[model samples]
Target: MRTWYEGAIRGFGMLVLLSGVGLAGATAARAASLDPAMLPKIQAATFEVVQAKPTGDTLSYERPLPLELLPYQERTDKYYSIGTAFAIGHNRYVTAGHVLLAGEASLWGPPELRDAAGRVYPIGKIEKFSLGKDFVVFTLAQPPAGDAALEVDASPALNQVVYAVGNALGTGVVIRDGLYTSDTPEQENGAWKWMRFSAAASPGNSGGPLLDKDGKLIGVVLMKSANENLNYALPIHEVLDAPSGNAEMESRIAYQLDLFDTVENSQLKARFALPVGLGDFYREFQSRIDANSDAQLKALLARESANLFPSGAGSARLLHQQTQLDGFPTLIVRGSDGEWRRAGGQAQRFALDGNGYVATGAVANNGLVRLRRPDGVAAATFYGDAKSRMDLLARTGMFQRAVAGEKVKITSLGKPVRESTHLDRWRRPWHVAVWPLPYANALVMAYSLPVPDGSVMLVRFTPPAHEHDTMLDLAEISSFVHVTYQGTLAQWKDFLGNPALQPATLKGIRIDFDYDHRFSYTSPRVAFSYPSTLQAVKPDNLLWLGFRFFLDGGKPVWDVGDVNVWKDTASDDHNNVNVQRYVAPPPGLDDDLSGRWRKLAEREYPYNGVARYENDLMKINAVVAPAAAGSQPSTVLYTAFYGTAGTQPQADMKGKLDLLTKDMRVTEH
Candidate 1:
């Protein structure tokens, strides 16, 4: 959203960086080899911080794992190496706060320690923690027998030899020597200096010990300089002198909602009693961070209150504006003038087997994709079927390749980890789902709305912490999602019969179909019923219903604006009839159609007219029906610019128009 905004709810994003790729908050410097006697102790004291084995494998992988992912064995390992931690005292261990926090809310199981021989030990109490400093001191549930703790060196001479040791790249413990470089102030408040070393530390080295020439702890390696081999490590004294039973988490947080680039910065400061188990500490940490996020969001909302939606002058203008008939969700943006404008993405299409295709594009931070049902898939199965929905989505080439650094073949997406439903501003129900990207520290979220033939979907990948904020954004945006259902009469019958398969919005809609006898559709705003003889909806007949959003009594609303029915082109010659609604002519512009409707609407009785424009390509015909804004009607010149279209009595079009309009009703409000 902005250069300053990391957009991960708060600073937990910092953890993803510290423990990913070849990143390290460490530095390099001169090194002198340690005495041979220290080798065994060094290895024994360090441990790989990993997630304990889960009860079961939840993911279904492609058979004969993708060749590009050469070492799929590690990808399937029960233990997931997160970072490094080392013995600092009898039963006590130290690691980066970020490393330990990764397991918070993770499905990967609790954090534990893996020794040189792969034996595992559960982690115990979190004795101390510092978010800003990025270090943690804790204990093991069961310490290795007779294992020695590393010696501490509070201050090591600059330019002296040092070693950065840990489970570098999850390949097991490794020792890399370098020089003790400069001392730089920690970025947030610079309350203390961090020992910068030139050690070749990598992602897995975080929480590992940076040792002096004598094998004593110089610092706890945390992160690497953005552009250099020099890395950062927390001084050992910071941990040694800290209160044993407290957590001091203070970090500078910057944030911005996805809609705009406006940013707000705040320092999150919270202190709570610790020396407690990891679960208890995490609960307190998350609670405080959530509060901080609320404050930041409130501040941003307050600053923009005068220009926000539905309450500002800009909102008034948008509400008064005419409906955009193009059915696709759009982003509501505030321009520099503080005027609200709709931002819609360009349509992009991808082909699939049969006549199936996917049309999608980006709307600001969100990617919007729309797909029509494939011929082989049943309409019943496509509705409210999570597995089939995601599978169809994956076929659109959205998410099937690499997660983190490993590439795996994806024949199927399996199922979402979480699934739920949300009702939009229009009262339409939408499907929401979240799928975890194994090892990626991220999630793929899908917001889907079912249409007659297919669905309109919103997809995005977010850092785990961002889910709450993202969901709120998606929920509001769903109201702006434009959709028009179109499908074969056969598909519609099967689809309309299942209320449980419909979103709440569709639940209120009723479709009566007496095969080869009668067909009718009724919604809150419109209704039409016709016998098979008037408009025969054979099993293969096609029907289209388009919805549009407009303001009714200054309140935004969405309803049917267009309806079209036609004979199946596959079995018959082109034949169609359509009825469209035009909202009342807004003040100002007086276009020809608006002027015609205004004049016709002035009649005392219901107005009716017909026109024919014949061309070499084809013959066109239309009938106009206009009536007064009924009891609750809107001046919405949508004031009777409405009517019905059906296979008319070819010989008496006028008589047919009168009959059809009598059987149909369209309300502009």
Candidate 2:
């Protein structure tokens, strides 16, 4: 079915005209007018329903215009002509419910109508509206003088010649003649039927009055079927024959508003809060299982189960453990009975057992466990860390491909439904959504909760058939699952007993050097040893001194060590180094420099200042010392070796940095 908005045109092709034989009777009747005597009255009653400053909040009802036509089309302050409304009584006007509801969310003001002479009339309080029937009636705040209401025909007959009068494409109200073809039941609620016609009602003809040969109102034009000339209208008697009491109308309005609010809220939540891509995984897995033979499917499930519940871990004793996952720090705790358990941020805790690791809270399936309901629904939860940024949209698209597989056609079932972020009993925030799978008989629901240290846990539930409502099941499972950490038994053993985990051991490094070229760099407040092959370059502002180093090939390298000694710079009081810089101190000297310098360095640099920065391209180190008793100022010695950001400098390069900063001195100029 197509809406009346011009934008609702779905394709670029011109409208295909149906054979004239089917519409011959109506075409001949057009010359005789519905009624020559009532023509003037019908024209006067019909007005162009133009909404100036159309509300922007509502979704666009029109189809995207072709790129070529867009440039020549005039930009209008007015939205599409919302079909048409005609005076039914002294000041009462009637139109389609959809036309008004489309703008109800962001309507600028009261809707207004324009007559053939270009006179505008404002609409007043809506007298009645019914979403079920797609009809609305309101009073004109200022009725046009001598504008009599159109008479309503309680009955409209099929095959009878009729006239459709309304603004066609916003040009003006034009009466089009056609024959009443047949009636079809409304799709949503089949309690009533719609009158089909062969009239050429365009985008602006919706809500216009459908008149019998006598010029009496028979129905209201609403929409047309795509690929055919068949149009539809609501019987006029449904509105005129119904009671017009304010209480009944108000009740109907309230019902429609409540329903609309629910739908809008659901759509908004889905757009922003729900986790994406889970549906694709579940759908694909289901399709794979369905296509395989029963024996093969069982084998597949067994393999998945094994991967999810590996047996190598068995059970292990707890020892001192230090590990980070999903941005959260975790600890290994030993129970009185000697069994080990992991616990830390976000209620992350799991028992070490041979029966497969079970979470203290929500179940953290090991990515392979296939969950099945008595109803044949299968579910799986995949755990992954967002350690490196991953595009959610791209991930979801990949899942779509998996589900579509080799031959099945996939159709989107509207948009995904999003629910508000709900906190589980463990107090973890989870984003959830229920998505209809492209499959004819299945639905996939999923929720994702955050883990510490930049990680995410996703759980997906897929029902066996689309008929099943898995929403409640998803909610129950998600609420019960707890965050958990899993690892091999060896990893746990090393975590608990390894002395290398100690802070001092982790930060310690040793260096020895044999210098090829050595010279002292002396500034006003400090002096440092650097390679004589390095060229000293002074900054234009004299804020610091730079030593340019070269590779063996004599190509100039930009990674240079800089020294700055200034009495007034705030950083002078405390050794300051950019986080990107690497620093390394001699084994025992880590705490030897008055303890103050060591404390500051450790607090500001990674690896507690032992190494300020190290990457594949280079490694850097710095040393700072305060001046004696009333000397000039504190001094800083900095050095770097060629390397990349993700790797460490070679042993030879490391030794150079140690020797370069060795013998660094702070003395008064």
| Winning candidate number (TM-score) | 1
Question: What tens digits encode model 2's per-residue C-alpha lDDT throughout 1-669?
Answer: 001122122221343211010000001113355556786787778876655543322111123323233222224324334557788888888887655543431223334676656677776656665545567677766789985789988777779998887666655667788899998775533657778888777776768888888888999887777677878788998887655432121111100010001110100000011111223322432332222223332343344332211111211111111111222222222233433354333333332222122121222321111111111111112122121111221212223322112322122323444444555433445555454432122344445553211123333435333212233333333433322321222222222243322112112211111233433334443455554333222111112222211121222222223433211223222221111122223234324333544444444442222443422234444444434624533223222222223444455445645555466554431
Model 1 CA RMSD to the hidden true structure, in angstroms = 5.8
CA shift at 392, candidate 1, in angstroms? 3.5
Residue-wise C-alpha lDDT for candidate 1, range 1-669, written one tens digit per residue = 222122212322232234633222222222347777787888888888887545543345555445445455464556777788998888989998888877776657778888877788888888888887777888877888995799888867889988998877777777888888899775555688878788888778889999999999989888775677787788999888887777987777775765556778877778899788878887888777767766777788799776666446666555544444443555666666766667666477767775666777787778888777787887777775878877766665555566446655565567788999888867776889998766455678889887766778888887665666677667766765666667777777776776654555567667776777776767765666666655566877777666655556666556666666665635232454455555554555337545655654563223334423233112233333324455663454322221233333334555434444556665334
- Best candidate, lDDT-wise? 1
**Residue 124 in candidate 2, Cα distance off native in Å:** 2.1
In Å, residue 421's CA in model 1 sits off its true spot by 2.4
Q: Assess the local accuracy of residue 550 in candidate 1 as a C-alpha lDDT between 0 and 100.
A: 53
TM-score of each model, in listed order: 0.78, 0.37
